[model samples]
Target: MKIASKLYRTGAFLAILLSSAGFTSCEKSLEEEAKTFINPDDFFTNETQCIQAVNGVYQTLYSIYSSPDYWRMVDLGTDVAYSIDVNSAVQNYEFGSGSNGTGSLWLNAYSGIKNANLVISRVAVAEIDNTIKQRILSEAKFLRALYYFNLSNTFGGVPLWTQEIDINAVSSLSRSSLADVRAQIIQDLTEAEMGLPLSYPSSDIGRVTKGAAQALLAKVYLFGKDWKNAKATALKVVNSGSYSLMTNYDQLFDVNTGFKNNKESIFEVQYLREPTSNTNTRTHSQISYYIPQRDAGKRTYAGVDFGNLVVDGWSVFLPTAKLVSMFEPGDKRKDIVLGFGFRDQKFTRFPKPGYPWFGSKFWDLNANGQSSGKNLYLLRYADVLLMLSEAENELGNTAESIRWMNMIRVRAGLPELAASTTRAEITNKIFNERAIEFVGEFQRRFDLNRWGKLIEAAKSVAVDNPVGAAKVKPFHQYYPIAQEEIIKNPNLEQNEGY
Candidate 1:
C-alpha cells in the first residue's frame, strides 16, 4: 500500500489540458491551452497556474451536462416529467450497471473529484501567499463537495477519495459508508464557507462564492433532515442581501444575456455558445432536447410559431399530464416553465392529441442549428426560500414556513396559503411548488428521492405515462453502480437490487 501510494505514478492530474468556461468576460475564459507532459511538482507555482488547474476542474461540468443521459436522469422520468423520445432506461426505472446514464454521471463526477483533488492537494502546498493559496483551495474544495454531493445522492455510498489517490492502487479501494461520505461533504463545505469570498469581480462572476457554499450546505442539511441547521443556513442566504427573485419568472429562463447570472441565481453552471465559435466545443444541444422540432423534419412539433426558435429538437421530454394539471389556476410560472400551446400571445393549438409538451424554459431564441449557449441553473434564491420553508415546516414553524412559501407563491401570481393550514399540508405545498418551479432545471428526481416518494411519485402519473410508471420500483431511488467499475476492482460490491 505504501509503495504504490507515492506521488502520482500515472500523473493523471498533471496531464490536464485546462479550458475555461465562457461566462460573459471571465478571467479564466482567456486561458490558453496547456501542453501535456508537465511535471506534477513543477506545477502550482503561481496564481495563474493554480487557476488554470482549477479551471480544468470546472471543465468537468461541461462533460457532466453534455452527457446524453444527464437530463433524463435528473428530470425526465419522474411524475412531473414524461419521456417520448428519451430512451434512457430511467424512463422505465430499469437501470443496469452498464447504463450509459449511470456511467456518465459516475465517471464525470469522479473525474471532477480527481480534478478538484489535484487542486486541493497541490495548491495547499504551493508556497504562494497564504491568502491566495487558501482562496484557490477553497474554490477547489467547494467544487469537490458538489461533485461528491451528486455522487452520494445518486449512488448511496461510493468510494470516498479525498486526497489524490494512487492510480496503481485505486482498484484496491472499497466503498465508504453513507455516513462517512456525508461527514466529508460537511467538512469540505464548512472549510469552503470560511475560505470563499462574498462575491467575485465581473471576470470571475460564476466561480463559487461564500453564498454558493452556504446554499448548498443548507440543501445538504435539508435533505438529511437536519431541520434546525438547514433553516438557519437558508435564512442566512435570504438575509445576505445578495440574491432575490426576478420580478418575472420568465426573466429567469429567457435568452437575455443580462439574466445569465442574475441576482436570483446563487450558483449556476455557466455555458456559452457563439454562432461560429467551435474553438472550445463547450457549446451543447441541451436547448434542442425539448424545444419543438421543425415543421418539415422532426416527428413532433407545435402548431404555432414558438417565437422563431431555430433548432432541431429530439422532443424526448415533456411534462406529464398530471404535472400540467397540478398548477394552480393563476400560477404565472406554468407557461414559462412548460411548453403546451402556442407561444404567441394568443393561445393556438393545444399539443394534446399527439404532443403534450416541449420544455419552454430551455428554449434558446438564438439557437443555431442544434446547439445553444444556455447556462444550467444549479441553485437559485427561489430554491433557498423554498428550502427554508421545508426546514421550518419540519420544525413546526408553520407560520414561518407559510410565510416563505407565500413569497414564492405570490411571485408566481398565486394566492398565498392560508395561515391556518396544517403542517402536513405545508409540506405538500412546498413539494408541489418546487416541482413546478424547477421544471427544466434538473432537480426533481433528487427532490422526490429525498422526500421518500420516488416510487409514489412515479405511480401517481401511471394514467398518463403507463409504460414508464409500470416499471417504477423502490430501489430506483438510487441507481446501481456501474458494472465496469466492479469488474475492474473486485473489492467493490454492487448496490442491492441491481
Candidate 2:
C-alpha cells in the first residue's frame, strides 16, 4: 500500500542519491540533498534537480538487484539454475494468481515508471538547457520502456502507466495488449537512441548510452519474433563501431566495485557498497545468497582472496549439473562458475571443499559489510551477438548465423561450428551457447520462454527433479496476475488459468 504512494506524486525528487542512505551511481558522490516529500511543482525547475529526479528512477533498480526474493523469482526454476530447496514454490511451479512469480519486481517497476513519468512530464515545462532537457527526457523514456519491457516479459499484458496517474483511480485501469506495450517500448527506445550520447565522460560511465537504446531495441525486436527488424537492428549495433566482445571473459564478468562500464557493456545497473554497517539497505546482496554461507568445515578451494581472506558466503541456489556439463572442455567461462573458496565467520578455513557455481563475477574481498557494491549487467555485447545468431538463423541466413555465433565460441576457447553445420544443428548450439554464456545472469528463463522451449527446458530439468517437471503446465508460460493487485484494482483481470 505504501509503495502505491509513488504513483500519486505529480513528479518530485526526494533527492534520492548522495543521501546518508548510501545511493552511489557514478563515481562522483552525487550532490542531491535527500528531500522528504512529493509535489513536482517544487522540483525540476533546474538542471541539478532534474538530474536528481532521474537518479530517483534509477534507485528503484536497487529493488530488483538487491533482494534475494527477486533473485529467487528470476533465477530458480530455470533449466540452468537449481533450487537448493526444490520444494520452493517457484522452483516447482506451484505458484498461482495469489502470487505473481516476480516477487516485488511488480511494485518496483511501477515505482520506476511513476518516477520516469514525473520526469518526462515536468522537465519539459521547465526552462533548462535545451540539449540537456531532451537528453533527460529521452533517458526517462528509455527507463520507462525498460520497466515496461520487464513487466511485459513476465506478466504478458500489464496495466501500462506511460506517465503519472491518480493513485485512487489506478483501479479503473485494465491491461493493455502486448502489441501496444511493445509499440510504446519501441517508440521510447527510438527517441532514446536519437537523444542519448554515443558515450559519456569517465564520471558518467554507468549511465545509459545511444548504443544501449539500440541494443535494447534489438532485443525487443527479437522478443517479438521480428526477425527482420532484430537482424537489422543488431547489425547496426555490430557495425556501429560502438562496442566489441571483451578479450578476457573473466574480467568482463568480474563485476566488483570498480569493474563496470567496460567496452563490452551496453547497459549496466550501477551499485556501490555503502559505509553503514547494515548490509541489507542500499547495496547489492548478491554474494550473500550466491556463495556458500559461513562454514565451520575447511574448504579445498583455490580462489582469489579478499584481503588475504577467503570470506564465507550463503548457499541458496546452485548451478544445475546440466548447466555445468554444457560447457565444453577448456571453455574459459566455466572457471568463472566452478570452484570457490571461503572461510567461516571466525575467519578460519572450514572443513567443506569449494562449491560449484560460486558467485565469482560478484565476489569482492573488499566488501564494506555483508554486501558488496557489485553492478549488474542489463545488456552486453555477447548477448547481442547471440541474439544476432538466433535472428539470422530465423531469417534463413545460415552462414551469417554461425558466423555470429562463432565469434562468441572462439572467444570462449571453444571451436567454431563446422561449415557443414545445418540450420537445425546451429539452432541447438545457439540454445546451448546461451546457457553457457549467460550462466548466473538470470537469462535462461527468458531465452527458453521466447524460443517456445520452456516445456522442453522443463523436461531437461526433469533429469534431476521429475516432480518439478511434472508441475509445469501450459499456463506456466506467463506468471499469474497477483491476487492482491486484482483486489486493489477490481477491474484488473487475472491471467488466464489463475
- Per residue, candidate 2 scores C-alpha lDDT tens digits across 112-144 of 787678778888888999888888888888899
Tell how far residue 274 is off in model 2, in angstroms: 7.4
Top-lDDT structure, candidate number? 1
- Measured against the true structure, the TM-scores of the candidates, in listed sequence, are 0.90, 0.86
- Candidates in order have lDDT scores of 0.76, 0.72
- TM-score (C-alpha, index-matched) for candidate 1: 0.90
Q: CA shift at 187, candidate 2, in angstroms? A: 1.1
Error of 2 at 220 (Å): 0.5
For this target, which candidate reaches the highest TM-score against the unseen true structure? 1
Q: Give model 1 RMSD, 1 decimal.
A: 7.3
Which pairs, if any, clash in model 2? 292-313, 292-314, 293-313, 293-314, 297-350, 297-351, 297-352, 298-350, 298-351
User: How many collisions per candidate?
Assistant: 0, 9
lDDT of each residue in 305-402, candidate 1, tens digit only: 65545667766676787788779998898777776655443323334564356555777777766777777888999999999989989999999999
